[model samples]
Target: MRIHKRDKARRRMLALLLAGVLAVTGASVLTVAAFAGQRQPPAQPAATRMGTVACGDVGSLLDQVPAAAQPAVDRDLADLDVQVADAYRSLMAPGAGGGEQRVMDALVAKRTTTLRNLKASAGPDAGLPGDLTGLASCGIRRDLVVDASARDYAPDAQAGSSGSSGPSGPAALSKGSGNRGSGLGRGFVDIRTVSPNVAKPARTGSATGTFTSQCGRNENRHLNPDNVIVAPGVSNGAHHMHDYVGNLITDAFSANNRLARAGTTCSNGDQSAYYWPVLRLLNGVTEKDAKAPGGGQDSNVGRILQPADVQITYNSAAGNKVQPMTRFLRIITGDAKALTNGPANAHASWSCTGFENRQLADKYPICPNGSRVVRTLKFPDCWDGKNIDSANHRTHTAFSQANGSCPKNFRAIPQLVERVAYDVPTGVRFAVDSFPEQLHNPVTDHGDFINVMNRNLLDQMVSCINEGRRCG
Candidate 1:
């Protein structure tokens, strides 16, 4: 009878685990092929600045933006798209239309309107917000937050829908040999070269806990619209969507004060929220693109792709005892700028299942016949010994060294490593859904966290980590 009761408990937990996957499926993207009649406008010479603020000044402007101002940030992108679409239509319409200069003037006016909207929404509390001139030029620069429907018309817009035919087979390979890595090289170096000596966790405690959620499950709640590290504020939750499998509510509004009171999927009652950018197939179309004015892109387009496995591990970094994860503590695992600026402070990377030999930097790997693609994100495990957050949201903690040891002046905390894999065919090219300037660079891939776990539940995780036991 005792054995029977124990088996019942295990079964119950399993049921709860499966029940946690949120329902997320089908995405859209806009393909230029869908454009009927009107030819694409001729390229105009670059403007001095993109929006009201020059691109060079965009970084500083982002500093003053606030998390509460995401709604306004989203509006700015929406307004820009509306203007671009209208202008393009007018230029291409079968009638007397504005010449290139007219288009340029229209772009300038639209940019000014967007800048004014940002300042008004930021309000006096944030003080004069940063200039938004770059939004027009860098329409797809990875950080701008935009609505799903509007994304189809966004810059570097690839054409395709999720259910439609994606980009045809692997990118045409260079002449000579037929094998992996034979295509025109785009700055891809094997990742194993840099991570060969890295340390794996010491052990899985009996109580090491885990929570699983289906990828592409909840588009509405998971995607992070802007750069988490750069634009901490202006948390516009648009542009890209994500899959979540923990605390129910996660958004610009997420806060420690009320998170504990929210609902959760963790059977143990964990309220922590885990999320990252949604992965899309390289067909040139996505769920978001499908909803555009024209039927979504049907040719190879970008759309959110589901992961074969979504594993969330809460384990010890000390390789000894598990440390308690502080309440409301925030952690950012990968460098968001790696794609555009190179891997200066980046910790995220992509590798193949069997070709573990090559851990790549910014570009996605061209896998062999049967190997699969994997995205590995390792979070910092060293805490400042105090403080749940820092002004930058990153300085409060540090990453464990290659040996898995925290630096001095910091304490070890449970480290989280998220591994997402996809069944991308042998050679079909794939790229992260980022800004047009990035060319789908993989370096932009990243993840974010806000510890809303109940205090009691956090203690339980701590016990499991410290006890050197894995729990689920």
Candidate 2:
């Protein structure tokens, strides 16, 4: 706590050097303290975050690759993801300041090799540039991760209805409780402060039927870190734990044939896979997977919460009668790296059980005692009608237009709507598991699923939608 004359002189000089640099959460202050020879925590966090490693997203650059080349390309893509995660880990270590350039340089070399292999896998017909120069290099991308507010959770008394049990009297968020290390406090906002922002679009099509699937919650404890759609046969591809329902035997090694043979949690015998990153209550509790790959090892900690209710439904489109989703069609609804990748593909929607009309895309909602946190993901329903999947895992499926109509050349399919609600404890702060660099930002939340319905069930779904009847 004492300052010497020589130290004061050095601080004055350093302060001049960082004249314009500013941090709201004490990162810059710590850098000045480093001159005092005191051990300090790393500043590679969202508060005073250094940044994230980013390469040009290669998947979007691809038009289409040969069907035979998919497996190798998927593996190489998964490898690139791991490389960036490793680089972030290094950057988070103490005394990693001047080492940023070295770490990024090494990451670029690794990505270059992987991009080369990926291009070769695509073969001559895939139409990839020979050098892949711009796509191969990676650098630190400046991401804005400042906390919007540190205000306490004080719900308005009138915010709760007569029948509701939350936030009216003594039920309030615990004071001074947080998990700042895992990015919790800053990501949450009191739901009472938000206004209604949701509006239902008008529909005019004759096909008014809706099909609901009774897929049970993850009562089976089926969890893993693999992503079968994007990173098949690659372990730890997601770098986080996922709550899975539907398919029984899904993993990174699961092929279409293997998935087809697996049992399901769906009551109708649907063998499809539906999964998303698990949400966690950041209350400093040790979980079973604390030392596991997708848990603490990947910078995702705290107690995982099981959904109190999970609803999966499919609705008809406004354009025409919905067609059957091609068996084994793969779809990813949100961007897992949205924090660094930008909001173009980000689709995570957060709300409270009763305050669902005020959906939040970037901040987590602080629900009252009786209320629970909710995550709703609406999957794309327009299909290209040719491939079961695409090189980018997105080109084959697309969202409907604002009027709920499919785009030109795209066929209308039953839109999948998933709503999962979590009973987060009173006063507890929470966040969904995300990539190490993503820092559990709500924007990085996403979901993945595949269609493995049998022919009879597919026909039933189409018939129900066309007939304007609600059937599960």
> Of the candidates shown, which would achieve the greatest TM-score relative to the real structure?
2
lDDT of 1 by residue, 132-205 (tens): 33333322121221222323222222211111112331111111121235442333333333334233555423
After superposition, the stretches of candidate 2 with alpha carbons farther than 4 Å from their true spots are: 1-49, 124-128, 146-184, 317-319
Root-mean-square deviation of candidate 2 = 12.9
Q: What TM-score does prediction 1 earn?
A: 0.57
- lDDT per model, in order? 0.47, 0.70
Q: In candidate 1, how many clashes are counted?
A: 60
RMSD of each: 15.0, 12.9
The TM-score, computed over Cα atoms with residue i paired to residue i, of candidate 2 is: 0.81
Measured on C-alpha atoms, candidate 2 has an lDDT of 0.70
